[model samples]
Target: MASPRPFSRYEFLIAWRYLRARRAEGGVSVMTWISLIGITLGVMALIATLAVRAGFRADFVDTILGANPHSTVSYAPSQVYNELTEETYFSPGTIQDYDALAARIAAIPGVTRADPAVRGKVMATQNGQRGLGDVYGVSAEAMAALPGVVDPERASGDIADYDRGIAIGIGLARTLGVGVGDRIQLVSPDGAQTAVGTTPRIESYEVVYIFSAGRWDIDEARIYMPLAAAQSFFNREGVADEIEVFVRDPERVDDWTPQLLSAAGERGQVWTWRDAAGSFLAALDMEDDVMFVILAILVLIASMNITSGLIMLVKNKGRDIGILRTMGLTEGAVLRVFFLCGAFTGVIGTAAGVVLGVALSLNVDHVMAALNALTGGNAWQPEVRGIYALHGELRAWDIFRAVALSLGLAFVVTIFPARRAARMNPVEALRYE
Candidate 1:
């Protein structure tokens, strides 16, 4: 053990004075400032990138799970041999006993709700404007229980009136230039059969409610109507196209697939949310990995600045180091002092970055809004991004990674210069001075 240990008061005091030197003192203060700023900005950029990526993922997932079913069980097409045609033909899938099937699914453990729904495409028109709409036929109870449909913040008009009228998405409302209590005409080509041919089923229903599902595609094309109304309109009075299943944990949907498949038997097949959005999610994951690697390289480049700063400091202080060594200062003490100088910059820069990164991530939407207001233009287009605003989320693990990266690089780069200072020959260092 030594009398004065490493990182002692005097070591730190000497490091502090060296760090605070002016331009006239051959201080290398300029390089110090530049390196410190580089580290700070690098860390901030890394944290902010992680937060934004996480936000995009969360936003994408929330919309998927909130607005769409975790899994869909639809009747599977079966091959039937027809004697009249003397050939086998595939019959279109339709759930004849939907009520029983939905009940069976709802009884399964971890299952939340099973809704039998009729789905179809129709042209919606109002005020001489027409847009294609995807209509979902669900019972009033199911509609009321839906997270996206019943969200108080995004939903308007009385839900109780939904039994008599129909509900529409905000995007559809915008397209038709209508609001709550307005009437919209739904025209479907697959309609009632007459002697001559099938006629289009055209019905006008008041838009009793409007909801935003936090997704542009869903909001623009989704419509909901009472089960009875949809059944009568679509000529599917006794059956549903499929059953939408909800569970306690959507992330664990694969775990429940076996149960769903077994319950469905040969009558139906299961389709999970993962199957619906797997490609997009995979792309996002690849993007996140690539972005992280690129930013890590940036951090390393920024950290190299620390090496530049320290080398300059060492060269300028060679004479001082030699004098200190002659005055009973050990080489270890010299090393510790320079190490402290570099370490201080890293610690302070990293701390500042953490604060700035967290602030930027937590308030990304607000910051974007301010920028949009200042520029008199919208930056986050909901139609393009599938979300209303930029979602930014800061995870503890991300912050830790950023801090570790900055400090680790700083420490590694400082070692090279610190060793050079420690190994300088006193005679050689002071010969020129």
Candidate 2:
């Protein structure tokens, strides 16, 4: 084992002095400036890219949670029956039991509310235009309990009237040329047969309110009506398709899902939004990972510039290095001196980059706005789904990761040139000068 040397303040001072003298030398090469600019740009790109990814991830999660219930319970495929003619679907049957189950689920820790829901795909038509939409049948109280649905103007007494009253998305209303007070026809795939064979059961509904969820898929493909009306329309009187549960903390939804399933008494399956919306979330994660890797390559390339700059410094100061060695400075001390110089260059460049990057990331929206204005409002909007506009969220961990990676790269870049400077023979260096 090597003995530990006493710390020397003078050694550090010597290192700093050598770095300052090199920096002040006349005719400093353009390569030095290029190195600094490279680092700055690399850091800026990394920060901006990560910020955008973080923003999109956050916005996507919020949009999904906002438009759908937190968790859902349904019968698993081939496990429990879902046929409209099942005994569970008759009057005075399992549909009435949902109220008791909802109460039981509500009593579970972290569970905020639970409601029965009926879901189906149906074709909606107004005038001559027809579009496919997801139909949800929910009780008036359940609709009120939902976060974004009820408002003063939109609320009409009780949700029971919602049996004949329906809420449609703004985009769908526009596409179909329908508005509040307009009647729309609904055709359910699972409607009861009238006589001889299959019959198209048709019902007209009055549009009561229009909502815009900012998500194109949801806003253009959903309609809400009372649960009983939907059950009657489908001829499934007693059973709901699923039970929707809202939780106090959405982050703990996975934890609560199993508990609710266990409480569902063996006839139902539980599904969290993480499961229902898995593909979208997975795509967002993959995008973030790929973007980060690409941006990190920029920083890696910048670190190479630091390495080249240090090599140039070593070449320019050969005679000075010879003099310092002749003055009894050890090779280790000489190495430390140039290493400090190179490392300090990295530190400064990386620090400046971090500051600039953070500023840009924090104000990305403003930057986008400025660009839009500069282009006379002709700038193309970012192609983002499920949100109103692009956003940037600066996470503390992301900033920390970027800084740490940059500093580490800078340190690694200093090593090779620092080693070469340490190994130079004083006699040969002086004779060459």
Instruction: Show how many residue pairs clash in every candidate, following the order shown.
Output: 0, 0
TM-scores of all predicted structures: 0.94, 0.85
> What lDDT does model 1 reach?
0.89
What is candidate 2's lDDT per residue for 382-425, written digit by digit as tens? Answer: 32355656678998888887888888888888899888998998
Please give, for residues 123-164, the per-residue lDDT of candidate 1 as tens digits.
Answer: 999999999999999999889877876898988899999998
TM-score of model 1 (CA atoms):
0.94
Candidate 2 residues lying further than 4 Å off, grouped into runs, are 1-28, 77-96, 148-164, 367-384
Pull out the clashing pairs in model 1.
Answer: none
- What's model 2's overall lDDT? 0.76
Backbone steric clashes in candidate 1, count: 0
